[model samples]
Target: MDVLIVGGGLVGASLAIALERLDLRVGLLEATPPGALPAVFDERNLSFAEATVNALTALGVMQKLRAPTGAIARIHISRRGDFGRGLLEASRYGRDEFGRVVVARDFGEALEARLADATRLVRHRPMRFLGFAESGDDVRAVRVADADGERVLHARLVVAADGTRSAVRDALGIGVEEHDYEQTLFVTRVRGSRPPDGTAYERLTDHGPTALLPRGDRHYGLIHAVARDQADAVASLDEAAFLARAQETFGWRAGRFLSCGPRSTHPAIRVVARQAIAPRAVLVGNAAQTIHPIGAQGFNLGLRDALTLAELIADARTIDAGADCGSDTLLQRYAARRREDRERTIGFSDGLARLTANDAPLLRPLRSLGLFAVDRVASAQSFLVGGAMGYRGDVPALCREVRA
Candidate 1:
C-alpha cells in the first residue's frame, strides 16, 4: 500500500476516498466496523459551510444525503454583556444559504457507503495497530492485529486520523499540548413549536457559549456549554427545568423549547500536537489537533487536511508516473501548507472559548463591539463567510465546483 490510514472514522474514511480518486493504494484500519444509520431519528447534526458542501458534492457523496433539511441562511451572535449584537444574512451576500446542516448519522452512512464502492481502498475492521518500524526512505512496515491474526503491511506513508486521543500519534512519541477548558457541553435535540427561521444562534452567557442549530422537522440541535460541576445538574434536570434554563439563557429567538431527546455531555478542551509530521508519517484530523467545538471547526478542519493531502498526492502523480505516493517531501509540503490555517483556527477557537467563558465587564463590550463591527463591515463579513466556508488558501480541486 502507498498509505496506511489509522482510523476509519470520518476523517480517515474521507481521506481514503480522496486519495483513491488519485489512483493511490490506501489501506484503512478501524477498531470498529462502520455503523449503519439509525432507523429512528437521532439528534447529532453537522454544520457544513459552502466550501465543505462543494467538496463533498464533488466527491459524489453529498447527493446521497437527505435534503430539504437544515440550511442556515443567517447567523445571529450576541453577548451576555450588551457590548455587541450582530446578525449576518445570506441575502446580504447574494447567497441563498450560508451553510447546510445535516444529521450526523446520515453523513457518516453516506461516506461509509461511498467507501464500500471505492475499489482502491482496503478496509479492515476489528483491527488494532500494534507498532511500526521505518525500513528505508520509501517504506514503513506496520503490524496490525485483526480477527484472523497478526499481519504486517508495508506502506510509504502512515496517516493518523484515529481522533483526539489517537493511539497512533501516541505510539509515534508525538508530544501534545492540551488545555482543558473545565467546561462541559450538553447536546441534545429539542422540538419547538416554532421554526428556526433558517438562522443559527450563538449566545454567550454566564455559564458559557450556547448554540442552537436548525434541524429537520421542527426540532433544533442544542449545545449548551456549562461548567463541569453544573453539567450533571443540568443533565439531570427535568425536561421542564431544562427548557426553562435553556429559554432563560437563549432568549426567545426560536420561540419556546418543547421537549428534548436523550442528552449527552462532553468535556470541552483544546489539544494540539507538538508536531504534525514525522519520518514517513503525518497526522491529520483530531489525531493532530482537537479544538473546542465553539465554532464547529473540528470536522471542517479535518476535511481540509484530507483534501489537501489528496491534492498533493494527485499533483505528485501527475508529475511522475512512477512517483512514490507517500514521499517524505510530499508529507513535509503538506505539513507546511497546513500550519498557517491550523494555527489560525486553533487560536481563534481557543480565544473565542476563553472570551465567551469570562464574565468580565470590559471584555464583554469588546466582544460585542467586535461582533457589531463584523456585522457592519463588508470585508469582515466576507472574511467570516470565507473562513466558515473552509476556503482559506488555494482551494483544492475537490473543494471547488466540479467542471462539467
Candidate 2:
C-alpha cells in the first residue's frame, strides 16, 4: 500500500475520501466493525466552517447525509457583565452563511456510506493497531490484531487520525504539550422561546464559554461550560433543572431556553503534538492537536490538515510515480506547510479559552477593548470572518471555494 491510515474516524475517513481520485493505493484501519457505532461519532453537535462544508461537499459526503443541517447566518459574541460585544453577519461579508451545524453521528454515517463506494480505498475493520517498525528505508511494517490473529501490513507511509490518545502517535514516541482548562463541558439540544433566526450565540463567562448553536429541526444545540469542581452537581441535574441553569448562565440572548434534550459532558483540555511527523509516519486531526472547543476549530483544523496532506501527496505522485510516499523530504514538507495554520489555530483557541475564563480586573478592560475593536473595526471583522470561514495559511483547493 502507498499509504495506510490508522483510525477510520472523521479525519481518517475524510482523508481516504479525499484521496480516492488520486492514483495511489490507500488503506484504512479502524477498530470499529462495519455495523458498530464509532466512539468518535456520538450525539455531539459540530460547527462546520464554510471551507469544511465546501470540501466535504466536493467529496460527496455532505450529499449523503440524511439529517438536516442548520445554517449559521450570524454570530453574536459577548462576555457576561460586559458592555462590549461583537456581531458578525454573513451578509456583511457577502456570504450566505458562515457555516453549517452538523450532528457528529450523522456525519459519521455519511462518511461510512461514502467510503463504501470508494473504488481506490481498502478497509480493515474490527482491527486494532499494535505498533509499527521501520522495515525498509521506504516502508513501514505495521502490526494489527483482530478476532482472527495478528498480522503485519507493510506500507510506504502511515497517517495517524486515531485521536487525542492516539496509539500510533505514542508508538512513534511523539510527546504532547497539554493544558487542563479545569472546566467541564455539557452538550445537548434545546428549544428556545423564540425560534432560531440563523444566529449562533457565544456567551463567555469567568468559568468558561457557553454556546447555543443553531441546528436544523428548529432547535438550538447547547454547550454549557462550568468549572470541574461543579461538574458533578451539573451532571446530576434533571432536565428541567438543567434547562433552568443553562438559561441563567446564558441570559435571555436567544430568548429563554424552553426545553432541552439529554445532556452529555466532556472534560475540556488542550493537547498539541510536539511534532507532526516522524520518519515514515505522520499524525493528523486530534492526534496532532486537541484544542478547547471555544471557537469550534478542532475538527475544522483537522480536516484542513488531512486535505493539505492529501494535496501534497497527490502532487508528489503527479511528479513521480516511483516517489517514496514516506520519504523524509515529503514528511518535512508536510510539517512546514502545516506549521503556520496549526500554530495560529491553537493559539487562537487556547488564548481565547484562557483569556475569557480569567476574571482579573485588569483583563476585563483589555477584553472589553478587544471586543469593542472587533465590533467597530471593519478590518477586525474581516479577519474574524476569514478565520471563522477557515481561510488561513495555504488553503486546499477544494476548500478554497464552493465546487461548481
Candidate 3:
C-alpha cells in the first residue's frame, strides 16, 4: 500500500477519501467496527468555515449528510457589558453565507456511508496500531491487532489521525506541548421562542465564552464555558434551573431559552505535538495539534493538512511513478508548508482562550474597545472575518477546489 492511515475519525476518514481521488493505494485501520461512529462525533455542533466546505465538497463528503444543516448568514460577537457588537455578514463579501453548521452525528453518518464505497481503498475495522519497526530501509512495518490476532503490514507512509491522545504519536515518542485553561465547556441544544434567523452568537462574559449557534430545526446550540470549579454544579442543575442560569448569563438576544437537550462537558486545552513528521510517519488532525475551539479552526486546519499532503504526493508521483511518498525530502516540505498556518492558528486559538477568559477589570474596557473596532472598522472586520472563514495566509489549492 502507498499509505496506511491509523485512526478513522473525521480527519483520518477524510484523508483516506482525499488520497483515493489521487489513485493511491490506501489502507485505513479503524479501531471501531465498520459502520460504528467514533465518540468524537457525539451530538455536538460543528461550524464549518467556507474553506472547509470547499474541501469537503471536493472530496464528495458533503453530499452524503442526511441530517438538517443550517447556514450561518452572520456571526454576532459581543461582550457582556459592551454597547457595540461585532457583526460579520455574508453580504459584505458577496457570499450567500459565511458557512454552514451541522451536527457531528450527521457528518459521521456521511463519512460511514462514504467508507462503504472503495475503488482502490482498503478499510480495516476492529484493527489498531500496536507499534512499528523497520521493515526495510524504504518502508516501515506496522503492527496491528485484530479479531484474527496481531499482524504486520508494510506501507511507505503512515498518517496519524488518531486524535489528541494519539496512540500512534505516543508510540513514536512525539512529545506534546499542552495547556490547560482551567475551564470546562458545557454544550447543549437549546430551544428559544424566536425562529431561527441564520445568525450565530459568541458572547464573552465574566463567566467565560457563551456561544448560541443556530440549528436547522429552529433550535439554538449552546456552548457555555465556565470555570472548572463550577462545572459540576452547573451540570447537576435541573433543566429549569439550567435554562434560567443560561438566560441570566446569555441575556435575551435569542429570546428566552425554554428547553435544552442533554448536557456534555469537556475541559478546554490546547495540545500541540512537538513533531508532526517522523522517519516514515506523518500526523494530521488532533494528532498534530489540538487547538481551543473558540475560532472553530481545529477541523479546518486538520483538513487542510490532509489535502496539502495529498496534493504534494500526487505531484511527486507524476514525476516518478515510484516516488518515495514518505521520504525525508517530502516530509520536510510538508513541515515547511504547514509552518505558517499551524503557528498562526495555534497562536490565534491560544490567544483567544486566554484573553476572553481573563476577568481583569482593567482589561475589560480594552477588550470591549477591540470589539467596537471590529464592528466599526472595515479593515478590522475583514481581518477577523477572514480568519474565521479560514482564509489564512497561503491557502492551499484543495481548499479552493470545490466543484460548486
Candidate 4:
C-alpha cells in the first residue's frame, strides 16, 4: 500500500479520501469491531469553524452527513458579573454564520458514507497496530493483528489517527506535554424557556466556563466546567436541580433553563505531542494534539493537519522527480509548515482555558476590558474573527474562496 492510515475515524478517513485522487493504493485499519464506529463519535457537540465547513464540503463529507446541523448566527461572550460583553454576529461579518455545530455521531456517519464508496481502498477492521519495522526502501512494515492472526503490511507511509492514547505514538517513543487542568467538563442537552434563536453563549463563571451551543430541535448543547471535587455533585443532581444550577451559573440572559437530557462527564486534560513526524509515521487528529474545549479549536486544528499533509503528499509526487513520500525531506517540510499554526492555536486555546477557568479578583476588571476591546475595538474584533474563521498565515487550499 502507498499509505496505511491507522484509526478509521474522521481525520484518517478524510485523509484517505483526499489521497485516493493520486496514483497510489491506500489501506485503512480500524481497531473497532466491524460495523461499529470509533469511540470518539458520541453525543458530544462539535463546533466547526467556517474554514472547517469549507474543507469538509470540498472533501464531500459535509454533503454526506445524515443528521441536521445548527448554524451559529451569533455568538454572545460574557463574564458572570461583568457588564462588558463580546458579540459576534453573522450579519456584521458579511456571512450567514461564523460556524456550524453538529453532533459527533452525525459527523461520524458522514465519514462512514464517504468510506463506503472507497472501492479501491483496503479496509482491515477489528485489528490492532502492534508495531512497525523499517523497510529497505525507507518505508514502514506495519504489523497488525486480528482474530485470524497477524501480518505485516508494507506501506510508503504510516498515518496515526488512533487518538490521544495512540498505540503508534507510544511505540515511537514520542513524548507528550500533558496538563491536568483539575477541571471536569459536564455535557448534556438543555432547553430554555423558548426555542433557540440561532445564538450561542459563552459565560465564564466563578465555578468555571460554561457554554450553550444552539442545537437542532431548538435545544442547546450544554458544556459546563466544574472543579474536580464538585463534578460528581453536579452530575448527580436531579433534572430540576441540574437546570437550576445551570441557570444560576449562566444567568437568565439566555432565558430560564427548563430541562436537561442525560448528563456526561469528562476530565479535562490537554495533550500535545512533542513531535508529529517519526521515521515513516505521522500523527494527525487527537493523536497530534488535544486542547481544552474553551475555544472549540481541537478538531478544527486536527482537520487542518490532515488537509496540510494531503497537499504536501500530492505536491511531492506531482512536482518532484523520483519523489519519496515518506522521505526525510517530505517529513521535515510537513513539520516546519505546521509548527506556526500549531503553536499559535495551542497558545490561544490554552490562554482562554486558563483565563476563564479561574475567577481571579485582580484580573476581573482587565478581563472585562479585553472583552470590551473584542467588541468595541475594530482591530481586536477583526483579529478574533479571523481566528474564529480559521484564517491563519498558511491557508489550506480547500478553505480558500476563489475571487471573482
Question: By lDDT, who's the top model here?
Answer: 2
lDDT of 2 by residue, 1-404 (tens): 99999989889999999988888899999999889758878879999999999999999999999999999999999999777999999998888899999999999999989998998799998899999854877789999999999999999899999999999999999999999999999999998888888999899999899999999878998999999999999999988899889889999989987888878899899999999999899999999999999989899999999999899988988899777878999999999999989999999999999999999888888889889988899988888888899998888888976655
- Candidate 3 — what's its lDDT? 0.86
Q: Count the backbone clashes (under 3 Å) in each candidate.
A: 1, 0, 0, 0
Summarize candidate 1's per-residue lDDT along 258-293 as a digit string, tens digits: 898888777887889999998888899999999988
Question: Please, what are the lDDT tens digits per residue for candidate 4 over residues 121-168?
Answer: 888898999997656766789888999998889988899998888898
Candidate 2 CA-lDDT value: 0.92
The lDDT of each candidate is 0.82, 0.92, 0.86, 0.85
Q: Kindly list the per-residue Cα lDDT of model 3 for residues 152-232, writing each as its tens digit.
A: 999999999999999999988999999988788888899998967999999887656889888887898889888889988
Which structure is stronger by TM-score: 2 or 3?
2
Check candidate 3 and list the clashing pairs: none
Error of 2 at 124 (Å): 0.5
- TM-score, cand. 1: 0.95
> Using alpha carbons, what is the TM-score of model 3?
0.97
**Candidate 1, superposed: residue stretches over 4 Å from native:** 34-42, 402-404
Q: Report the lDDT of model 1 for residue 390.
A: 73
Ten contiguous residues with the weakest lDDT in model 2: 395-404
TM-score, cand. 2 vs. native = 0.98
